[model samples]
Target: MSAPNSLKDVYLDEMKDLWSANDQMTRAVKQLGEKVSDPKLKQMLEHSVGGIEKHTGVLKQLIEAAGGQAEPEHCKGMEGLVTEALKHGIKEASSDGKLQDVAIIAQYQRMSHYGLAGFGSAAAYAKVLGMSDAETKLKQAVSEIYKGDEYASKLAEAVEQAAA
Candidate 1:
């Protein structure tokens, strides 16, 4: 996308970038889910795929609502995070189930945090532009992401304790 001359452009661009980010994250989460030994971790990852898809839909809606094409511009930031997730959570993952679970949660949270930042920023932009509907949806997505991140943190703690 070209440089944004207005807040609307930035907001739309953020939504488009989030679309690509969600798509990339969905694939990575699925791959991570398949590799996880912990049933709880696996379940969370599976559930998150659906959540990510829903958020992707919201992003599409927001982009179109703002009179922008829903087409996603590839997010280089998410691309890097996904690469790191695969490398650490899968490629160099430990043989120990508990250790691998820790790595997976860490990777998942890293990606989720990026989403939180993007979605939160988009929501702020929407609020500044007086688009209450857009702001509400974006904020909702951020809240959901935060919930997942919190769950992952708790799960990580449980896994670490179990390994001790």
Candidate 2:
């Protein structure tokens, strides 16, 4: 894609990046879920997978609404995060199930926070462009991402307590 020359173009670029990020996150979360031993943590990751799918659809709609093709650009940031997550959450914590759960929760939050920032920014851009529908959708996505993040935080507390 060419350099974004307008606000709408920038919004499109952001949507593409977010689409890629969400796709990568969904895959990583599923892999993490498979490795997690705790039932509650596993369930949380499973639920998040659905939300991530819905959010990706929303991003596609928003991209079309903005008059852009819904093709995802490679999200290198998410790629790096996922790499680290797999290395530490799965690879490094193989010997300790509890520690693996803790690592997954931490990595999940890091990814969720990234999603929050992207959705928040996209919503703001939509609002600035006077695209109320896009803004509302993006805001809803942000809320969903936040719920996952909050769940991870609670899970982290539980994991820490278990470790103590």
Candidate 3:
């Protein structure tokens, strides 16, 4: 596709990026769940996969509504985040479950923050373009991501105490 020339175009690009990010996160969280030994953290990660799938579907619908193809543009930012997460949260912390849980929480927050920013931006663009329905959906996705991030933060506190 070409460079975004209008607010609608920008919104479509944001949706595509989010779609890719959610796809990557779904896989990353599943793999991280397998590596984590903390029952609570494992369960949270498992639940996150479902949320990511739902958000991805929402993004696809938004893209189609905007007259854009419902396909993902590669999200290099998410790719980098996932790679680093696997290395630090899984491979490097293999011997320590508590530490792995901590790493996973940190990595999860980083990715969630990215999603928050992307969805927030998309919602703003949607508002500017008078696309109220798209804006509402994007805001809903942001709320869900924020809740997950808050949960991860609580888990991080528990993991920290355990590690100490």
Candidate 4:
């Protein structure tokens, strides 16, 4: 078997990937805020945009603490995924308030799931790297995003189901 990378290298690489994804989402959320007609969805997007910016700052601090560069390598994967989501939302556009809200919630939750997974992994890496404060902060971030996704889904489901 090929030799595995050193633990520090592995952790740093994961942070880089997460940083790239965050960079992509940071811009994507703003564009997304404009795409959805629902006021609530727009607010959620705005809130998430702020949270992502905060997460990016924490990531930068963590990377620098690890002796790695704080700069991000752009994540084309998240960019394409978000772009496609926007396109799909547009193509399937509707005036029905409930349907539009459902679409926005689904897309937002999907993105949140991505963030939760990435952040959770990063937290584990930070813990392994002996970064106690970074681990705690990342853990909190992952939990908060997961809760937001659940709350949004519940609100959207209530609207969709009521309309149905």
Indicate which candidate wins on TM-score: 1
Tell me which of candidates 2 and 3 scores higher on lDDT. Answer: 2
Model 4 ranges off by over 4 Å = 1-4
lDDT (10s digit) by residue, model 1, range 45-94: 99999999999999998898899997999999999999999999999999
* Clashing residue pairs for model 2: none
List per-prediction Cα lDDT, in the order shown.
0.95, 0.90, 0.90, 0.75
- 28-128 per-residue lDDT for model 3 (tens digits): 98888998888999999999999999999999888888899989999999999999988888888758789878888898888889899999999999999
TM-score of the candidate numbered 1?
0.98
Q: What are the TM-scores, per candidate, against the unseen true structure?
A: 0.98, 0.97, 0.97, 0.86
Worst 10-residue lDDT window, candidate 1:
61-70
Q: Give lDDT for model 2.
A: 0.90
Off by over 4 Å in 1: none
Cα lDDT of model 2 by residue, 1-164, tens digit: 79989999888989899999999999999999999988999999999999999999999988987789869999999999999988889888857788788888999998888899999999999999999999999999899888788878998899878866
Summing lDDT over every window of 10 consecutive residues in candidate 2, give the lowest-scoring window: 91-100
Question: Lowest lDDT 10-mer window, candidate 3?
Answer: 91-100
Which candidate, 1 or 4, has the higher lDDT?
Answer: 1
C-alpha RMSD of each candidate structure in angstroms: 0.6, 0.9, 0.9, 2.8
| lDDT (Cα, 0-100) at 5 in candidate 1 | 99
Per residue, candidate 4 scores C-alpha lDDT tens digits across 1-164 of: 12337777766766777788877776766866777666777787788888888888888888898888777766566777677667655557567766766776777677777778878887888888788987998898898888788778877877688558
